[model samples]
Target: MFQNRHNLSERQVEILVGNLLRYGVLFSSALVLLGGVLYLIYHGKETPNYQIFRGEPPAFRSPEGVATSALSGRRRGIIQLGLLLLIATPVARVAFSLLAFMRQRDITYIILTLIVLTGLIISFIAG
Candidate 1:
């Protein structure tokens, strides 16, 4: 039984990663679409004022804020959350690659992936 529990092949890992990316994108898109529809339903009739410019609220800036607003069913917050998810997808892929490299005992790849993951994290945090 222990012998039957073998590690995944390279191709299997690739397929799993592909599926993860595909599903992540699809799910995020769905959220964005849902949020857009709800936003339109709520504000479609409002007239636009081109001379005035406004930015996203503070509540939609941070991940925690987005999550809170999204949980409260705020349309803009839902959209922001979807965008955040889109950004996170690639970061997640890199993280998964790091794990895969570790599992495969590929030191070079593990180090490279760790560097990339670290860069991504730093960029997000620094921004």
Candidate 2:
């Protein structure tokens, strides 16, 4: 007679391959999600209604038969959330990666942290 005993060895994997899989998933998904956030920010930045430097509002009749600001409340709401996500994601990613590195002393965490931190700094400075 045999029992369905738990075999810890069955679940164990080679360390390097395991680490590679983990870091691959983390960085790949992070980059993919970051791309989406960047797209949102880019589109928000390009929208005519979101442009802050437009000196003259176009002459257009409102529903009340008067000129209305292109800076509509709905546009502001979308733009605000887009910009916040664009700015927040990378910052949070770097902070969490740094903390992970501190806890585990992993080089993968260090590398990812450096890349994200540099990206965030360059973004604010160049942007």
In TM-score terms, which candidate is top? 1
What is the clash count for each candidate, in the order shown? 0, 0
Error of 2 at 88 (Å): 1.5
Per residue, candidate 2 scores C-alpha lDDT tens digits across 42-114 of 6756646565565422332122211122134233333333444444554664665576565556788678788
Q: What tens-digit string does per-residue lDDT give for candidate 1 at 1-127?
A: 3433235467678988999899999999999999999999999899999898898788987899999999999999888889889999999999998888888889999999999999999999899
- Per-candidate Cα lDDT values, in order, are 0.89, 0.50
- The pairs that clash in candidate 2 are none
TM-scores of all models?
Answer: 0.90, 0.35
TM-score of 1: 0.90
Residue 16, candidate 1: Cα error in Å is 1.1
State the displacement of the C-alpha of residue 86, model 2, in Å, after optimal TM-score superposition: 4.0
Task: Give candidate 2's TM-score.
Answer: 0.35
Candidate 2 global lDDT = 0.50
